[model samples]
Target: MFESIKYLQKGNQKRAYQAISELDIMKHLAAYNPILCGTLPIGIDIACSDLDIIMEVDEFERFEEQVRELYGNQQNFKVKKLHIRENPVIKANFWFSGFEFELFGQALPVKEQNAYLHMVIEDAVMKRHPSIKKEVIELKEKGWKTEPAFCKVLQLEEGDPYKELINYGKNTGFI
Candidate 1:
């Protein structure tokens, strides 16, 4: 259902952020919910303490759905509406719902992304560095800044994330 659930947390920071970033990018690419939540630069600043979102349809209805899921269903995610110049792409504000995070955006074909994302997340969660996730959770609980090292291990640059995401997806069989 929700691709976010595909991420199995091994309790590492780099892994969590890797998962977060991967999912965030995937949602945006999918454009299922154009705007990603929790990524506003003008909001409360904390690299390890903010949620991000990407959305489904119109911003308003999207908001309502998120609310219903959160309060009604007891979810752990937040929201924000980001209008991206890229047509069909919307990045929004973000928040957490327990371990389940949500980010929505333009429809980017995810079959490819999912595969690579799974591999990236799988390697991080199951091998390579398992502690990154745990550290992320610990730092998150303590409300401290933490960065994902997996991207670094993979040598990913933060700018223009689409290409890297596609590579991951294609390599991993999500496509």
Candidate 2:
């Protein structure tokens, strides 16, 4: 269901749809399941929000090679290998169609990746508590990353906000 950009073609996401479609990003990265994640999808994006595309990649080297071949020549293109939560990840960043793009890949299912999970939970929270969106956007504009802003607004004062949000989602039946 996350494969298509049809939903992104409406509302504030229309520009993002145009950018991704113009670049044919999904078509080129079809081998790995790619799902658009992060602030834009959830409608809490600020002026500087970048497009975040999460992919399921079993081999970092191959993923890096493919990303390099596809976007390495783009403006400000750069790829690097890093580890998050002890899991190896390959990330590529570049500017295209007036948008900054972040391609993140890990050896985990796209649906299971933390970025995707966070987006899902954040969306649910916003849906359930509509006013939270305004607070989130304000925090984001003030340079707060999505998760930390969420934690502050939600009063999730303890534990890792990232992991705690998942649990919060479960407890609130928002996940």
Query: lDDT of each model, Cα atoms only?
Result: 0.40, 0.89
As for candidate 2, its clashing pairs are: none
RMSD of each: 10.0, 1.1
| Candidate 2, 38-96: lDDT as tens digits | 99877788889999999999988888888899899999999989889899998999999
Which has the greatest lDDT?
Answer: 2
Can you write out model 1's per-residue Cα lDDT over 15-117, one digit (the tens) per residue?
4446455545444334443322221211222344444443344445564564555333334334445444345443333333323444444444442223224
TM-score between model 1 and native: 0.35
Name the regions of candidate 2 deviating beyond 4 angstroms. none
**Highest TM-score, which number?**
2
- Residue 75 deviation, candidate 2, in Å? 0.7
Compute the lDDT of residue 149 as modeled in candidate 2.
91
For candidate 1, the C-alpha RMSD (Å) to the true structure equals 10.0
Task: Predict model 1's lDDT versus the native.
Answer: 0.40
